[model samples]
Target: MPKESYNVIGVMSGTSLDGIDLAHVVFEVSDGNWTFDIEESQTISYSDAWLQKLKIAVNFHKDELEKLNSDYTILLGETIRGFIEKHGIGNLDAVCSHGHTILHQPHNGFTLQIGNLPKIAKIAGQKVICDFRVEDVALGGQGAPLVPIGDRILFSDYDYCLNLGGFSNVSFENHGLRLAFDISPVNTVLNFYANRLGFEYDDKGKLAESGKIDHELLSSLNNLAYYRQSFPKSLGFEFVKNTVLPLIESFDVSDIDKLRTFTEHIAVQIASALPKKSGKLLATGGGAYNRFLISRMQEQLPQIKIEIPEKKILEFKEALIFALLGVLKMRNETNVLASVTGAKRDHSSGKSYEN
Candidate 1:
């Protein structure tokens, strides 16, 4: 029989480069239903040196990337150790990590997430389950927006699960299948412009609120080919660098104007992706805190009720879900959904390493 309960640490580093999110989670299975509690959670900000390296890592050569991968694994191990010791965590069954993504081009049949090396298990002194995306992509899937499984199992009360992380993505059941796709860029683009103005983020979009929308830029963004694509699609740093940034840079607008225009674009795209029917939308991730953005989305999606959960769920939902993925992997159960990712079939995905 499968174990009834598990305690694990879920570590996540998003494209927004906000920091490393560590969540100590307890998952219990009762009568085939799953429940989770995030006992402790924290975000550890990255240093300037690490931040600079990671931002340019996608352009690194194969050997360089391998070295960085090893270094990052060590860094992740050390960080997880600190988190465990600081919280006095004990009896950990495993550490489930969504190692920081560097290159996510599923079209090319590969995606790379650093810090999943075997050395991590040794350094952290615990069993580790990670690299969850590669297998899904190997089976011909987008290999992203992996949190929908958690949404389906843990938070099934809502009709839609929308996450505004580095990128914006949404998942919901339709026609007896879970459908999901990336809607638009979020902090990945906004924070880039915000950094130019000497701020980490827009602080509830106050900067964007003060700025005017550039209609021309907005139209260009909306017309991008990615928007017209079907579901099971995703966005990555390459998309931002090659497609999004160039389009925005073509307009000689103020930084605040760019932020405002992009924020509006994000809201419109997200609203457009939803079904016309009225239902509850559960919003989470860092972007959920951007009050102005959420208000704009509310305006566009008036019929759909947008609900934001408590602070813990808002910030650490992805990490918590990654923990669930690890648990599913340990049980040899399906964690990656074929319908959501467009994989060949649903399967348990992740490599496990014992310390």
Candidate 2:
């Protein structure tokens, strides 16, 4: 028997503004299979100041954004250093991070993810892999829903893979090709409304469960032109701010009513993305804890059997997937999917930093 080598830190901050999730994992690749052992994981919540700053950064002047990018890189470096010290695990290989997505408007030909990689490498004293989306976007891809590559590689046993994080996105094989995209808004809008209600999120969906579903609202959401646009489409903060929020605000809807209706809408769009019942489906992301949302999705999607994996997968799946993408990039494997992201071709994405 021989000793195996494994150690890496994965960092992910999603669009829901939930804050940063850090996973200390053992990614052991051997015998043509991948084995992941998550030794430690923690989430650091964002301060009110950070959240507000991120919201405004979307509209920031170029110079201001550039400045903030440097600042953010320092911020991430500090966070990772603290995380490493607290965990007390050594023998590090690398740190893979999916930094905060600041601006994602691929149609307009730009996406900004600001966090200083050199700074992270400097502070963390580890080889770093960050900025995982730019190269694909350069090829005219949506530069999002990048986790499908991980899903296809790590959890390929499942027929479909859906993640309900700040946003709900899904990936499944169709005609021998893996396809994935953002289905619709999830915690991004839910947290927005929940913040209005003085909470970070609608816990267990109790608030939504207590209220009535507005059929009219559900109909409007279901009829949104984006739903009919076909696959490979993604939703973002701008979509929520510009389209979803405005439409929801125009109506004199109750808080619970809005929550209930929106949960249903999420369930609807998620159901639409699923393929016909074949094998089990793997569902992860923060939104999986919303018992009401999960129940609703289960009811609507009777054909697909949905299973939420262990807590580590449910909470840190995106971070873990981003880490896997980083690994693929290190190996120079095909990471981006042309069919899923509308890129000119499948390519390796992300930049590397050496300490």
Candidate 3:
């Protein structure tokens, strides 16, 4: 498709395992200026059973996972069709999906996102674009943090753009190149603790306020090996289930103290990722709802300004970015950042399917 002729739906399910976000967007390129319209958007929360299945997706055996992959694609197709009907979207150029990230162990040179292709086309009766990370990872990159390209193109005004979803990643252009990576796990770790107290998440960080910070735990978590790793890296659900949970368990502490300490750890790491200059830092995702986490970030470093946009923007920014990614892929433009993921070179990485 030509740059001037593109309209897409970008689907995204983050590592948070929160839900699927779908956006019907119209992208246009005129006189080399890229623009977009978010026509409609909605989130489809996972059912208890689906949540449980996806929670353990990182641990599924190969054959079982392969089956679930196709099944999940069918499930997504149904959801997307319902979204289209609900919003009265028509003449969609394509549905661009960032299939759920199941495993991201780039060191072992492997990553997986399981949403079958042909099954999706069969079910949706529409062209689809998915499986966006493997190509970059195969080319010696962290098959993750692929959002910076969107940030660079669509949200170029911000000095720093930070996403506080399942993981914390900041994007910014430096030295004539865009730099981004997984800074730390945000909602993934916080939501885990909050769930123990019969809450889905620490809404506005109220639970965290009731909890006391364990300085020792805070120090220990801040010193994790992953934090010391260089850029072009990412985190996985398995890493959290295997590495993070065990490390927290080793302390044998209460959930409150765990939340308190972890919030501080997040603050330290996030503050460190800020550029050594003064500018506005846009914060988004579910973590923005965690007031306690935001407070810790402010207390740790008052130099950087953490600006949260409108509610819809905070919730659907990733979904919106994915929509833009689809626009780029459709135009055969580079959506992956070489400076961020250390890919052999910048490139557009996705496989598109036609119905």
Best by TM-score: 1
Provide the global lDDT of candidate 3 against the true structure: 0.84
The TM-scores of all predictions, comma-separated, are 0.99, 0.95, 0.97
Which TM-score value belongs to model 2? 0.95
Clashing pairs in 2: 73-116
Write model 3 residue lDDT over 190-241, tens digit each, in one string: 9999999889998888888888888888888788898888787788877788
* Worst 10-residue lDDT window, candidate 1: 270-279
How far off is residue 267 in model 2, in Å? 0.7
lDDT of every predicted structure (CA atoms): 0.94, 0.85, 0.84
The residue-by-residue lDDT of candidate 2 on 1-355, one tens digit each, is 4234557888998887788999998888776578888889999988888888887887899899888888888888889999999979788878999889888988888787878457789888788988988887889899988998888879999998988887888888889888998889999888887878888789999888888988988898888888888767877788888889888888789988999899999998888767575468888988999999999988887776789999998999988887878777777778888888989998888889998
Model 2 regions more than 4 Å off: 1-4
Model 1, residue pairs in steric clash: none
Error of 1 at 187 (Å): 0.3
How do the candidates rank by lDDT, highest first? 1, 2, 3
